[model samples]
Target: MALTYLRHQLHLHRHKIIGFFLLALLSSGQQTLAQGKLKGENLPGYEHKRLRWGFSLGVNASWYQLEHSELYVEAIKSNPDFSVNEKTGIGFNVNFISSYRLSPDFVLRAQPGVGYHSRAIEYKGMPADDDNGIAGGDVTQEMNTFAGELPLLVKYESKRRKNSQMYFIAGVKPSLVVGGQKKGSEYLQVKSLDFAVEYGVGLDMFYPFFKFAPEIRYSRGISNIHKPSPGMFNNSIQQLNTNTITLYLNFE
Candidate 1:
């Protein structure tokens, strides 16, 4: 009788342990199911919402123009005998961007960008004429500048189901002149700093799975960037107008 009682007690204990383990397994499964449902609720409905970080590299065909100033003509005519060539050139830029969704249709973006620029002038004409040339004699001038820029823009996505979007951007970019020089012997110094009010329109085409976005932008600078040479008797004016078009690849 005692042996039978002991065997019965052992069997009861084993059954209890097995029951506890089964209960724990069921509870764990329930928890996992509940967590999965919560995760599904937090998933984004729009395709673009999945894009939050990206990088962009592109080229900018830039036009650098001097503002209209009476002093400009005066300076060219100081010697009154040389011709001046003013022309815009091409440039390149790279960018890193971070995007944050403000709404289903709107996003805020911050982009830090860098670029290289070049412009040139060739002087020609009669050296003896006072009404047509410069005091520096016949000369050619070429300037190459490197600039760093940062832009913060609010972007509006198109409501269409296509992968294309249109955006209007307004921002401020301050650029520093890192390198430049005149071709001839005339001593010239470019201004070290330029501030611009930037406004532009851009279009972006997103690839499948949000892997990359290729975009094109057109922007205009609203400030002048010229500093007159010192000790001049006239009110020397400065010109600082820039027009830039950029093509970028945004990777998210």
Candidate 2:
């Protein structure tokens, strides 16, 4: 009898329960839509400024792209163990940004900055030496550099979606070595000037006071930066190009 009574109660309240759930779902969806619309309205017309200024802090991982000389290739035929290995190095940078709005979807930017970088190349199966840390018949050459960077880029932006917009940037950067190489011990040498092409993608977040962006960029050098020296390790490399990946946090 209690089961029959329970069944009758469920049948009578089923339509009311369904209505309650439907109302709750509709209310939740409407609230979500309203919040999204509100978010989309943030920083309206922020991109219409003729000029803007900002700054960025970044961390970078850098490595060398190397081409072996013909002499080195011939040497490798006789000694297969003769090899050079590039090790990735990490560094930091800071940039002051200047931007000009060309259109709603496009902007021009220039960033001038300074960075400190370290990179290493390992020579395997080298002659054992007591003086230069090659006691085990291998030597690692580490280069630490401080450089000034100037980059000019074009940025293309997507339509804003809820408080954030996506963008793509492509540019060229020219750098000059400011410091960080000590004179003496001559295993490897690098030129003072380097130029690279850079490309990246970022998301611009709108805030009440300012804008913020987090970006990831790739850089590739078009010219060889290696300077030839009178050393086996230096002569073995025909070309050395720069390759770096950087993650940046920007504020405007």
lDDT of 1 by residue, 1-252 (tens): 332244335543323433443454345445444544454322235445635777777655555565435754766666555444454445567778888887777778888878776544444552432332336445545456777777777777665334444565566777766555433223333566766665555444344355344455666766665555542211223565666666555666
Candidate with top lDDT is 2
- Clash totals for all models, in order? 10, 0
The 0-to-1 C-alpha lDDT of every candidate, in the order given, reads 0.55, 0.77
Q: For residues 1-252, what per-residue lDDT tens digits would candidate 2 score against the true structure?
A: 332244335552323433443454345445544656776466778877889999999877677889988877887788788888776666778999999999889999999999877777889986444554334357778777889999899999998776677789999999998997655335678888999999988777777788877777788999899887655667688899998777777888
Displacement of residue 179 (Cα, Å) in model 2 is: 1.2
- Highest TM-score among the candidates is held by which one? 2
Which segments of model 1 are wrong by more than 4 Å? 1-51, 68-85, 126-138, 180-187, 209-211, 230-237
Instruction: Return the lDDT, model 2, position 31.
Output: 50
